[model samples]
Target: MDTRRPTIADVAKRAGVSKGLVSFVFNDKPGVAAPTRVRILAAAEELGWQPDPVARSLSTQRAAALGLVVRRDPTVLAADPFFPAFMAGVETALTERRQVLVLSLVPDAAAETATYRSLAAHRRVDGVLLTDLRHDDDRFPLLAELGLPAVCVGRPDVAGAFPVVNLDDAAGLRSAVDHLVGLGHRRIAYVGGDVGMLHGRRRRKSFLEALARHGLDPVGVVDTDFSAAAGARAVVELLAGAVLPTALVFASDPMAVAGLAVLQRQGVQVPRDCSVTGFDGMDLGRHLHPALTTVEADPLAWGRAAATVLLRLLDDGRADDLELPSAALVLRSSTAPPPDPPG
Candidate 1:
């Protein structure tokens, strides 16, 4: 009854091959014939043997890992479906290449910056994926100085050295506004997330511009931090106002969902008393009572594309910015004509 983790020597002994050959095969180095490579891999698999990350790093100066430093409260991150879907995509890409993802959740911008510095200083990761691109992002300069290759998830206010994999944030928001306008929602209100982030601002601007295109003025606009609590607070503020808008468009699904809950609590019937719309097209939105109408963008695709780009940058020392398809609005039961249209 021996209980011990198997080692490379065990794999080699099982396969009747030298440990050096096993190393060569595991590292994907050439010179090991195809049959021998397969046989060695089979032995390692049977023995449950894997390379030691520390030894691999020291030997090749490659951590074989990617970094993702998120600046968000722990609760906030868990509440947002976007991060999980996006990380799933990133991990999917990394798993194919036998790489690991090193995630760091920080409380604020300063802490995020320090985490990036620490990762780079220790060579903990080969590269990083930058999410939540902000206005006047200082991380670009720091990452460049640290020589840490990165891929930005969204468009930055100013372009920098790294590549970006961003969708057109304005297109989806504009489409949401247009749908509401077409539904005869003239006195529409908007609930947007942090305008400090570039994507947030882009969405807000798009909503305003779309309303202007229809020659309609927004009844009200509320800003939140894209968290459910912030979204709920914004809804309360909107409800407290003297008059209520016919339709409300939210920047994220969680916000729209929260707003819907608030509307329900206030005895406001959706699409009857007020129409509602959301962004992100989260899966949870689909299961709502009336189902949610939303603008659908592929955050999962963004993660995959970003990871691919970052890995390429690490390997080739350069990668090109990618532009995915603009998010499109999907109509559902959440939106309809205003209850009381002008005669």
Candidate 2:
């Protein structure tokens, strides 16, 4: 009645390899022949033997995890619809490789920087996924100094020091703006997130440029923190302003949803008085009456792509930048020509 757990020595014996060689295979150390490594792993699998996670990390100097440090207000992060699908996709990819995600929801820049340093210095993760790239990003050199591999989720202004998973943010905003212009909305307004972030800057620039192409200027531009309260506040000001816009283009679905409510509450007839459009194409948009018109860019796909790239980089020490699909406008009942075409 021997019911002992299988050991690495058993795996080595079954594969006709030395104990040290078996250790090398599990640690994913270099200098092991590819075919022999495969055979050793197969033997371990057959015996249902696996090295302890702590022991493996100590030996391999890898945590078998990836880091994602988000710097935002907790309340704002909780309401952001982009994460649900994006995180689902990231987890899907990491799970395949027996890896996990280490998310840090930090409140400020100092905490964000400290978190990255600690994660890198302690070897707590194989690498990190950089999001919310800022104007004149400081993370690039910091990551380089720490020798921590990273994948930027957006293109930074400067040359990338690591792989990039660039999204077509401009395309989405342009589509929203173009739709407004097509609908005879000369006085179109833009509601954007913080201009310091690349996505916010890109969308705002695109909105202005799109209108410039049509010989029109934005009736208004409100920069908020992509919060429901901020969105509601922006809408109130726009509605109360001296010159009301015929259409509103919100940079995020949450903001759009909030604005939609505000407009309806104030007795503003959507499409009859002022049409509305949003970005990110979230489900909440569709649930609202006169479903929100938005740009169809898949955040889930973006997350999946980013995770795939980071995993590849961690494996081989290098990965190439990838450009995801461009966004297109999803027309809905929320958008239409102005009630009275401006002469």
Candidate 3:
């Protein structure tokens, strides 16, 4: 009945095994017999000798903290439903192992690099999660130089020996374009995100490929930042042309909502006059008037997957580059064939 925070020795004594055997079992090391392993586990559980993660890390030369670096406004991240949902998934994965998540927001590449270096120097975090990657991103090379266990959420042009978790952006966009084309849309306008981001680049490339496949050159291609206001402005610019497109593919749900409002204000009948398709299946998209046709990406699942992979890298000293599932096209009332032209 000794109850002073039972140690590995206590577990070994209770199981009638050596301390080394207990260590091997607790550290997930191979070579212990099956029957003996079960007995050791049961003894540890009975004595409440659950391995102290912090102490184990100290002995094993590993850090227990996981750093998540997001290059965006913290306020925007807090308010955005997508990030919150994704965080939920990440938390769920971490909770199972009782690990802490340290999130950081950096405005620029220099600040981001500084933060990573500080974290690494202090050995405060074993691994890091990098989001919002751009073409020729500085973080890619810097992370490689630091030799830190890291996972990038987006694909960066710089190739290195680090794990990456990339979304199937091209497939998602292809599905969106195919849906609109199937709806008899010929002159489709594209409202995309900043060309600097990899996801935006992939979306635009898919859009152009879809247009070529249909033997129809896109009527317009406007790039804007990921904001509702930007989406509205892009739509207006497209409409200013001599021939208005019959349908529009917006790169984000926020932009799609803005575009929808603009069309309504201009007395354009959605589906009847112009069809709209949006990426990111936001909750608001489902509630929009003539509900938005959108590509549904599961942010929660993506976040959980990212966290799980990062955790592995932290705990096992192994890097895993994984490609997550792509978004699915969710058809709704926002899209329809172009209205018949008067003879």
Q: What TM-score number comes out for model 1? A: 0.83
**C-alpha TM-score for every candidate:** 0.83, 0.85, 0.83
Where model 1 places Cα greater than 4 Å from the true spot, the runs are 1-60
- Among these predictions, the greatest TM-score belongs to 2
lDDT of 2 by residue, 41-160 (tens): 999999999998877767666788998988888888898878777887788899988899999999988998899999988888889988888988998989999988999988888997
Residue 169, candidate 3: C-alpha displacement in angstroms: 1.9
Which structure among the candidates has the greatest lDDT?
1
Q: Candidate 3 lDDT, tens digit per residue, 233-252? A: 99999999977999999888
* Best-to-worst lDDT order: 1, 2, 3
Deviating ranges (above 4 Å) for candidate 3: 1-55, 74-81
Minimum summed lDDT over a 10-residue window in model 2 is located at 53-62
lDDT of 3: 0.83
Measured by TM-score, how close is model 2 to the native structure? 0.85
In terms of lDDT, the poorest run of 10 residues in model 3 is 73-82
- Go through the candidates in order and give each one's C-alpha lDDT: 0.88, 0.87, 0.83
